[model samples]
Target: MISALTAPAPRAGNRAPRPIYVTKGGDMLNPFTPTPTDPPSYLAKYTARDTAPGLARRDAVRTLLSWGLEQLADAAELVVSELVTNVLSHTSTRTINVTLIRTGETTARIVVMDTDRTEIVLPACPGDDEEAGRGLRLVASMAVQWGVERVVTGKLIWCDLQEDR
Candidate 1:
């Protein structure tokens, strides 16, 4: 069983971090190997019920902050809260899954996956008087990058953050 994960440093002259996984045995696991059944590398996965979206968001941010990535805690908190709540709002699934990953020494990725088949329309800028509709705005402002992907189960929204250092 894979008990832990770590992202390998980016190669020389490269800015993108290599998404690698480290097991308890200290061996590197390739997430995109020839094996089609291999799961994507992730540090943790939290499952939450539809009745408690806040709890899921809190727990995910807490887990991320605990992984020695305190520098991006605020960003993680905002992104996770927004995306998870969006999932709760969009889908009728009894439960939702939040996946946390360390993509690099100072970078982390948070993905919220739901079972809804509907396409997600990325949020656009909101007006000054708007009270809502700024979830994706917050995500865009803080995340180094953010995007949505269509998966077999449903759609997954993700955001990446990097330490200021």
Candidate 2:
């Protein structure tokens, strides 16, 4: 698994940090308040064909931060890129959907849906001479928790992130 590097909290003298909410598709049902029944704070939807240029993933993460999820922006973006790349490389589907949700004041979730239902396995980290095989490892390291769920038409791979409240 790829290890996550945590930067120390900002020094006390710095101004208070701004709220960060990074989402990909869907709308932010609650921008300021966190409620029990409310949906995720940010959402993103895409199709298999949407994975062509990697910038889409970056834009999606930026949108979430703009909507108020700055803390999760970087990790979410990395996860999105790795997951989406896997979908494009392994599945025959032409579209996929990605969503980012703030489940609690200190937790966020990243979900990727694809028409393919095959299980994903992370390949062993290769030597410096190898060109690939490290995506899922990165996901395992960065996410606090993660797994896959089978759906009627496809599957969803999701991960959880614990944030600093």
Candidate 3:
């Protein structure tokens, strides 16, 4: 299932509020019209078992990000950290899938899928003195928009960050 939520405030009077699209399973929407030359530049898949190896998952993320636009590298790393950490902490599933797809020279989508369907709630950022919290906040701040989508056995959470045109 894919669900959408909009930001609380509107940026313009005439424009309709844009929904922050979220999905769990298969492709939620075809955001792009058919384009022949704009095939994905690189594609990489990682399973849950890959996360067991220390630093392997992080390295995979870094490697994938390296192939795409450079500007989104930091946000990609942060999102990977939070999503992977959530899987490690909240579920017994050891494997999570990460796929990087380059839709255009300046656009890419980072998807993290795990065998848990629980909705991710971005909690309020904690005070500087606090020790925990703030992962999703960082994700929300960095990604253009993100949300969870439920699948048959698990769920997929994805975020998109636009690179320079």
Predicted structure with the largest TM-score when compared to the true one: 1
Q: Rank the candidates by lDDT, best first.
A: 2, 1, 3
* Per-residue C-alpha lDDT of model 3 across residues 105-132, encoded as one tens digit per residue: 6666767777765665546669999976
Tens-digit per-residue lDDT, 1-165, candidate 1: 443344577789976554344334212221212111123233333344443455555655565555677887777777877887777766765456676777787887788777778776777678899888888878888988889899998888888889992
Regions of model 3 farther than 4 Å from truth: 1-38, 41-68, 117-129
Regions of candidate 2 where Cα sits further than 4 Å from its true position: 1-37, 50-56, 119-128
Tens-place lDDT per residue, model 2, 1-165, is: 222344456788975444444343432222222222366544444555554326446655665565576777777778888888878877886567666677766567878788876665546769889888888878889889898878887887899976552
Show model 1 residue runs off by greater than 4 Å.
1-51
Question: What lDDT score goes with residue 111 in model 1?
Answer: 80
TM-score for each prediction? 0.66, 0.65, 0.59
Pairs of colliding residues, candidate 3: 23-149, 24-149, 24-150, 48-95, 48-96
lDDT of each: 0.66, 0.66, 0.59
Find the 10 residues in a row with the least total lDDT in model 1: 28-37
Per-model RMSD to reference: 10.0, 13.5, 13.7
- Deviation from truth (RMSD, Å), model 2: 13.5
* Model 3, position 159: C-alpha lDDT score: 78
